[model samples]
Target: MQKFLFELNRNADFQSRYLSDRRDAMNGFDLSDEERHALAEPDIGLLFHLGVNGQILMHFAAFHEIEWQDYLQQMRDGIAAHGPVREGVYAVTGYEGVDAHSSRLSKTSDAEKGS
Candidate 1:
């Protein structure tokens, strides 16, 4: 996962290369089929749930033209739909109990109120 993210960040031509030929772009990586599918789908939620680092994930989100807020929301939605973060930096003990939709609504309301 880190290798894939690194390539996406370090290679100037990676996006074009990936878009043009995914199999070729991914040829040398040691990713599992599931990981490869996540990348292909650019499923930010699943990627986060799979324990991708935030720094790496942030860049990946940018690569997909997703804004920061949406990126965060996607992570939350991932938890809501797929359960807690599985590992890595974002893992937590009680995420399964979190009410993601209500949390999102609260945050949106707070933002609207200039808070």
Candidate 2:
């Protein structure tokens, strides 16, 4: 997927709220045209370290699409591809339950790499 290095905006509450809202929005398949358009839009805000110091890398939006599992995996793969080399990344999603982000690449990986 496309690499987007970004920093956390606001506090953890922002993330909590975003997770909640995103979960609610994705829970069902019934999405309006606007929702579909937004989802289709390539906007992924990424967070990563950019240098030797604690410099923050922030990209407000970088959009992309993939299967839910692959979307999560690309998050990890993007990090591994750019961030510190890590073996695993894990978190719980209210919608998908437990989820993992890893460095595994896929055939369509090239399509998502350019932007």
Candidate 3:
């Protein structure tokens, strides 16, 4: 997905192809059904929960003409509806959430130092 977004951002030919036929543009990539659905549906929120980088996603949203505030709200809504990111560095472990993972790592580090 990141690759697709990156290409969409940088590759004019791909961008033109995507603007013309989204499904066709997506044909070459190994996107999962969910990813394809989100792209096809243009679900910004779901894409966020899928762990698409925000910087990359912003372009996707912009390409779709999504307003900036609306894009932010969609991400928040995705978190509310989907719990946390499901992939990438932001992925939640057991739904503890992204920040919780950092806290867990911190606590583990502190415990190790104490020992």
Tens digits of lDDT, candidate 1, 3-97? 78878877879978988877668878998887888888888988888888889999988988999899999987877778877887666543443
Q: Which of the two, 2 or 3, has more TM-score?
A: 3
C-alpha RMSD of each candidate structure in angstroms = 5.8, 16.6, 4.6
lDDT of 2 by residue, 4-55 (tens): 1121233455345444565343334554454333333422212221121112
Show where candidate 2 strays beyond 4 Å.
1-65, 84-115
| Pairs of residues at least 3 apart in sequence or in different chains that clash in candidate 3 | none
Lowest lDDT 10-mer window, candidate 2?
48-57
**Model 3 stretches astray by more than 4 angstroms:** 92-115
lDDT of 3: 0.85
TM-score of each: 0.74, 0.22, 0.76
Whole-model lDDT per candidate: 0.81, 0.33, 0.85
Off by over 4 Å in 1: 92-115
Q: Sorted on TM-score, highest at the top, how do the candidates line up? A: 3, 1, 2
lDDT of 3 by residue, 1-115 (tens): 8888898888889889988888889988999999998888798989989999888999989988999999999988888897778887665434465467689999999999999
